[model samples]
Target chain A: MPSLPPIRPEDVAVAEKTRPHGAFDPPSDAHDPVRAGYLMRLGDDALILGQRLSEWCGHAPSVEVDLSLANVALDLIGQATLLLNEAGDADTLAFKRDVLDFRNCWLVEQPNGDFARTMVRQLLFSTWQHMLYQRLTASRDEALAGIAAKAVKEVAYHRELAAEWVIRLGDGTEESTKRTLDGLAWCWRFVPELFEVDAEVEAAVSAGIAVDPRDFEAEYRAEITRALGEAGLPVPDDQRPILGGRRGHHSEHLGHLLAIMQYLPRTYPDAKW
Target chain B: MSDWPLWEVFVRSKGGLAHRHFGSVHAPDAEIALRHARDTYTRRMEGVSLWVVRSSDIVASDPDDAGQLFEPAADKVYRHPTFYEIPDEVKHI
Candidate 1:
């Protein structure tokens, strides 16, 4: 692996102020409507997964793993906040939307199972995000580009952490190895959803505001292949694209997730922390 | 399972300065150790650089040697830069 460059204080200070361009603007037709939806979907994916990961807060295998998972969750939440805050006020988008209106894929809404399953989800999602964000950093849309630039750094670390755990679990004991393989098998079908392109994405690509999901397939495949290889796992031969999130049709899991997540605020609508 | 080891943390605030000891946290290894240090110590943007060292690796002077080690140096007037006077002509001294 390449050495990480030294982080300069000036760079950190600069990044603190780096936010989406649309943060100050309400959704406007002049600003590429398709791109706006695409950005929202990206934000929704991060937000949903972050919420899912937060479930493991007090339940990880160890303190080290707990903190590590929490850190990744925080990063995803931060990205979600930036993207959603730009799309509209974050609170409204996160709390006010109907379940059918959400744009996150079904895979992200699935309940985090055991440690192996969570790691499987993390590995699958972060690998896709790593490729997606890398391309997004250079997007023509300045705000999305800025968000992607900062996010790539966070997601890169997430990928590394997930990849490390996959190796450890896959190669460790017989029981762990079996569980890791089962976890991968359980999640493999959802992998195609990450690459499912939609009309909104097509328009965004035409407008040069977003990269086509199809563009990332090769890179995403290579990353997963290498990681699985190192883990002594085989790639399952079955490949089928599962589509819905981009169309605003999510799994049943999302409703349950939202109910729990929004309960505190919904029950006590005027409560303040 | 083996207990996670504690690590001492140091953080560099910005350019042109050395890292100072920040605090410590428990982690399984150095990579996760640094990540833990970042999440715990620098979440509020207190640092630009992080360094994590195993707590066990740090060597310390014995409490009995404190008088001979540090107290003797306190009385050395020649070692104090305050004894030297800088002329007004010097700009950054």
Candidate 2:
């Protein structure tokens, strides 16, 4: 794969503000790409993970689980729409972007492994997202704050749903425990990427357009630690963190995901309901 | 998953409404069952409250005894309030 071009922080910071077309009026600075990028990063996280979760639509272990996963997927997609709309036209951003334009964390783009693995990923991502949204609800940016206010409640339930499964699978029978641990191992490496603060993020933070995730890294870890401990699982030792995705540098998996996600939109280009 | 117990779900759509039977879900415990019920039955703002009980706990009437249990009530038309004269002041009744 071609290496992604380095993100230009100035390009993000200097873009002029423009009004959105719809009923939703974002804050005056919403079109500044730095702020837009900030919002897109959050939206991309939701959009990608929402797509991944929807893969379980007809394939979950039970009918109830299928509905639950789909429900969460829909919630994430809804969040993505609102967040992306703040940045630009949501449909165009979602369907027209190339792999290198995506700003999601690498964690969300990782493929869903087994059921246990999916639950583990959900637990980790939702916990961070919940905290992030809670902080964003207080942001000086009205659009970010308003989006976060609505999203915090959704991520709270997402956190609860995943935590319950993590505890159950980790402390359940031997086979389940094994699968859950394997899931954790597969997912643990990606946690640090969620907290990474790069130049764009730094700009967004310094401008008070975004929260510094590093500020709450300890609390985030403690939250995960508590959940792991309850599941009778030991926290894995911190290792090298898998980074990139915020800057559009993603693993091979994201390319595959984008190919599928962008297919219909790219194919017809004008197909509409 | 088939080995998991079945739970019957009840949903109260609004305050002052009794919970009516909604559907069933399979879960290992009541807490999970309640979560499943929320996802399955209330996704469309269908309920303000939810109740989940183990399906096995409900003692249902036997279909074989249906005639003896309910047929006698069908013939009692006087049990209807139509025999009473309507008082205009009580128009709602």
Candidate 3:
């Protein structure tokens, strides 16, 4: 293990000046910029999805599903709490960051259109997240490794929740099958974006601080086909890859989501929960 | 959809303790019943194990049968442990 450099008080001052909690612009050249960006990417995925799933709190098709989705949302928020805490102050990282500053993958930011849509989205993201975190457990960065190790188990359960629902819906009544198939269609375009690598991610992988998610692209494809196939749903391949979230580019859906989710913190900047 | 059938949940908090009925949930099938059981009953890390059975599967005598069912035991004082001279050294007893 290479020794991390000694932390100077000036380093803290510089980091804060470059990137305060509510600042609109990300730091241009902060220390460990790639690592900080990677942590934000990880944090934003959980935060966005956690916000999306929370919308189902009172409106699920069934009470069981309501609790199930809420529990899944709770788990993602728990992950967000830890991951964002690592990058910066957890509350500020979540509540203060502007929508354009979030580095979540495009898939997680898609709207939860309906129950089928939400579950299918979860199935896709959680499966990838499980694979991503499993690989990250071996990262040379101790904080990333420790967070990934704990989160891997949580995502395994999330994958199960999503997979089971996909099977249940896809194999259920004619209406359910149609809805689930349509749901998959809604999210299919965003699938390939998960594997898109940028300079920062590339550097992190080279430095052993992160794993290249593209490396597991083949396995992810196979796992998806297996899980969805058993549920009698085919992997839809007609859609094109839609990329951008890692670079702070997002869909129109995210702005609407942020309007509702960020309203409180933005409105009452000084108030406590 | 209407509520799934109700399942009574029982949990074993620790070794050597009997599985005590905690609460219940509604699920369409046994597998989902177990999932719901875990989510609802064990979210607090309250138990080592879970059991979910259809609430209707449990047979219950009428509450009206209270006298005939359990009253006899009340008068059977000899069957009670009060008469035992429990020794201080008998740890668990």
Candidate 4:
């Protein structure tokens, strides 16, 4: 029943972005504040990853791949837009928020090192995302459930595409196999963070509006293992797990990414599309 | 290191409809070719079904030889469905 007020059209560019996080919070608000933050983080993960994938629009190795990547990016961006829309205007939430305020996983923010690396990242994320949305389709919150229903279908295709590529490159020639191995290794460290049950997520799960990401870990591991095995690769030895993306800490890459992503909005200020 | 074979794609928009050629995409093998077809051609829900055929396997008649191949059929009145007149009671025809 609780919803954030829509921003006035004139204030979208300035007042919304400049206002601090707590500035809009009402002390006696009825809903769980942490759950609201969880939704925002979920939206953030999609938005940031969407932005990362969009970087490959014209640069993928083949024209088919270029279109595939763009399609996937478009899907994630659509999810982000809707999820963010639940909180506030999607544009302000995406382009206006500072890096520290973003709540995406570090795995998504990593630069696309190569076609193999990008595919590996997609494989990892989509596999996890497919399961996440599948479970979230039953979320007690109807809005989240509806979004999950639509999102699971899209992520299913993304998972299939990425998994196939992982197998192709892993079973491919010497160079491609080497690249898949390296790409898998590069992405290995971020695996644990995808299921991190931080405070907001915990609260959301307790409220039944979110899935406890931990519940999907067993299947997540099995699916990734299966995809990697199909690719003829071994799982890397566990490294110290990276955390904190849920808490808004990110790698060096996201700031630079945002610098470009936010440039137009920051530069033009009130300029309308 | 070699590029995938070229495959022409066909899409059926609905049940009981004929598949029509949409476009071609290149993939390393048949399965990949089908996937590429799905990704490249059907992302918009444009098709209910898909078919992919290797460009090499299809023996397409040369367009330059069209007159020699089938041009004679164009003037064959007996081959036309409309060549026979139906009685007035045969309204559906």
Per-candidate DockQ values are 0.25, 0.80, 0.46, 0.45
How well does candidate 3 reproduce the true complex, by DockQ?
Answer: 0.46
Q: Arrange candidates by TM-score, highest first: which order?
A: 2, 3, 4, 1
TM-score, chain A only, candidate 2, equals 0.90
Kindly give the stretch of ten consecutive residues in candidate 4 chain A with the minimal lDDT sum.
Answer: A23-32
Q: List CA RMSD, all candidates.
A: 7.9, 9.2, 8.8, 8.0
Q: Write the per-residue lDDT of candidate 3 for residues A103-164, one digit (tens) a residue.
A: 99989988888899899999999999999999999999887899999989989999998998
lDDT of each: 0.85, 0.92, 0.87, 0.86
* Candidate 3 accuracy as lDDT: 0.87
How far residue A48's Cα lies from its native spot in candidate 4, in Å, is 1.0
Q: By DockQ, who's the top model here? A: 2
**lDDT tens per residue, model 2, B9-86:** 999999977899998999989999999999989999999999999999999999999999999999999899887788
Model 2: fraction of the reference interface contacts it also forms: 1.00
Looking at model 4, the pairs that clash are none
Where does candidate 2 stray beyond 4 Å? A1-30, B82-93
**Candidate 3 chain B, poorest ten consecutive residues by summed lDDT:** B84-93
Candidate 2 chain A least-lDDT 10 residues: A13-22
Instruction: List, residue by residue over B6-69, the lDDT tens digit for candidate 3.
Output: 9999999877777899998888789888888888878888899889999999998999999999
Q: What residue runs in model 4 are displaced by over 4 Å at the alpha carbon?
A: A1-32, B83-93
